[model samples]
Target: MARQETQCVIHHSKLTSYCNVCGEFVCNLCKQSKYGKHEGHHYMTVTEKTNELKEEISEYQKMITDKSLKPLRENIHEHYLVKSRLDSNCDELTSEVEKREKHFIKEIQRASQKLKNIINGHRLEFSPGLASRIAQLEDKKREIDSLMKTCENVINTGNTYEILEFSKTKKSDLNTTHSSPRQVPKLELHTPRSGSLVGDSFGNIRKSRAIFTDEIKVLKSWSYDMYIENMFTRNDCVWISKTGFFVSVKPKTAEEVERKLCPVHPSGFIVTTSGEIIYSVSNEHCIYKITPALTVRLKHSYPYLPCGLCLAINGGFYVTMHKHGADGKIVHYFNEECADWLEIMCYRKGVSLLKKPIKIVENGNRDLWVVDAASESVIAMNSAGKFKFEYTGSRTCFEPIGICTDSRYNVLISDFGHKMIDILLQDGRFLTSIKLQPLGISRPMGLCVTKDGHLCVGQGNGCVHVLRY
Candidate 1:
């Protein structure tokens, strides 16, 4: 069977050649036509073009294998190796924990039994004799009491003769002396020296320290015309909340791919694990969640104005809020269903936990890091709402606004006043600082740690800087 040639729609002619300049298959008439679109374009036979493309594809295959696939495969293999080692180390730790648990249980049981035996010995040695002595003393006391009462009644009601007779009869009994008071023996059991779960006596777990350097590498930067108040990364893209809307932009191309306008500007926003945007408007009393399809829904209504938002490790979230014209800034924890579960109000002695919390983030260890701009510090608390530590910058003019935590659980705070990102250990110890001024990152406010460990910083000057930490 013979193959039919392709016909050109414009001229109804058989297509026999390809135009390199126009990048289209052309008929002989197309090139020969004086007034045609491809009149002066270079032409080549279809077979020749096919052969050229085959050669180019062969080169591309080699380039891909050497430059891309090979390196990716090696990296994947390294990840698997690391994962295997991690699993083995975790198993050993678990076994060690179990062994320690068994040893502690046995020791506790032995100590309890010893104390019980001492108590039983004390009871056997002193109980019966003490009971008998008490009974005999009680009988003697009753006899003396009755005699005195009879003597008093005769003196009060009878005549002098009755009083004298009563006195003479009671004199011998009254002269009898009682035994001196004796101290009772007491059984004192000392509590055994106990160890704490978090104390060094029991053992402790330490996190892997994040390796850092003073060199700040800016992997990508995007500039916008609108002011970026808050931004969070979702995969390769980031959703930035501007004045009255949220825009999703690709940092690589600096392209605004999607935009959703809001009635009010958000005080803070966060991208959840499920690709939902949870934000709070400071003037409003409710938190809102925007689904992936940009459908907005009310998440929760609270008594105070909600602001900073963060997702918890247990599929919950934290929202920092405060009453209008009030100083008692508090935080609320909500479940995955957006139902309020816990409210952190004050510390010991009714001390305020946060003065002006502008942002919040949860680290890998479930510690909540809140940026208290009014306090000029980053307050940290455990997952159970116990205050951990407050990290006020070592500098005098510290003004922290944005906060996020890295994989190592180290808290990262963007200091707008210092124009730098301060890194601290989970215990609130200042580890280091990344000066963003040198890298052209001014007024760094909103922060999000990308999945690949890059730090996405949204600055006040309409710039988003992605740093490789």
Candidate 2:
């Protein structure tokens, strides 16, 4: 074989100008075409530029490596901290579960001991008839034990045939026992033990009779004219004075035929806190604040038709608007001049604040409670309008038109349709419903709980009913 000739690597070189700073090649003609001002600019050959670029790249990589380690160190530290907190929480939960399990086991043991005592007491009264029943029960127990043992063996050994056979036998035995109705013994039923009753002597009886106090006297009823007449009737909203008195208002049309103005028509009567007669009014869109001297003052004008009003914990009054908005429109106003006012009413997600807001009351926590007649739900929100929870009213046309909270945080919602009241816990748990007697509450509008815990509800019959729990 002929010896292979060595081939030399030939490198191409041309008159190319390279930028000294950026290492880009430029033809000699382009470099020569530069103006007089740029002729002195630093330029280099391709080989020199390449070597300079390699040195700069190595330095740049070192700089990048120095900067990248900081975030990596912080991330590792954060991961360790999170892992430690998770481990601590897991240990705490495990301990809590174990403690609960121990308590549950002790409770089960106590129950078992109590049951054993009951069984032993029954055995002590066993006669010949009971002995025959016990023998039958023992035979049934033995049969059940044998069936259970077979089932366990089949399950452990994964034997389908044996499992099917045992299941069929058990089913047949159950069917036979179920077909034969067993006769139970008619033993004397034991009466539950009661504490000893104490008898009162003649003198004690007389002393108890003497403890009767003075009876409450009823107040005389007053006649009041219907101040609201010939107007589109909206609702009746009422408010009590600081000294526990009643004041009501409703809407009435203006006499001017061209100008159909809806004004507040006042009812001229008031009631005392002790179920005594006071005065009343039939006004519209205006809040009547009663004085101690029985004089009514128009505190503020309601933007829309007002249905209910209640005093908040901050002394600010909350009034519900009964006006129907256009379809798909929901707007809430804090005051009558909402259009001119800068501050807008707050609202939360998933809550339609303006949908038939009828009754507004403040709870012990100073949170506002609203009864939406359209939605048939009672909604509770914080002062800042953050939604807390909602209690759905009954489905049977029990429209909740009045709502109030007692001192114990028990919510009382008045259903105008059902002519009754539903009580609920603060957490929206249903407690019970109270049905009003004589069933003529045309519309239960407003509710208030007195300082003595007496619930006072306003009905459409121009009367307020008081109930004591």
Models 1 onward score TM values of 0.53, 0.37
Error of 1 at 207 (Å): 19
* Candidate achieving the largest lDDT: 1
Task: List candidate 2 stretches off by more than 4 Å.
Answer: 1-307, 322-353, 438-443
User: Which structure among the candidates has the greatest TM-score?
Assistant: 1
TM-score of 1: 0.53
Write down the TM-score for model 2. 0.37
lDDT of 1 by residue, 47-88 (tens): 899899999999999999999999999999999999999999
Question: For model 1, where is the 10-residue window of minimal lDDT?
Answer: 201-210
lDDT of 2 at 91: 100
Q: Count the backbone clashes (under 3 Å) in each candidate.
A: 0, 20
Cα displacement (Å) at residue 428, model 2? 1.4
For model 2, how does the per-residue alpha-carbon lDDT over 1-469 read when each residue is reduced to its tens digit? 1222121112122435575554445544444444222244578866686788899999998877778877788889999999999999999978976885676556556656665665567655568987888898778778777866765455434334665677777787677763543767676534322111111222333343333211212121111232111111112222332123223322111111221111333222223233222221223554454343444444344445555554434433455555546211212333322322111132556545547665566678766777776778777876545677877775566577667677788888878777777777777766666666443344565566555545565655545544544
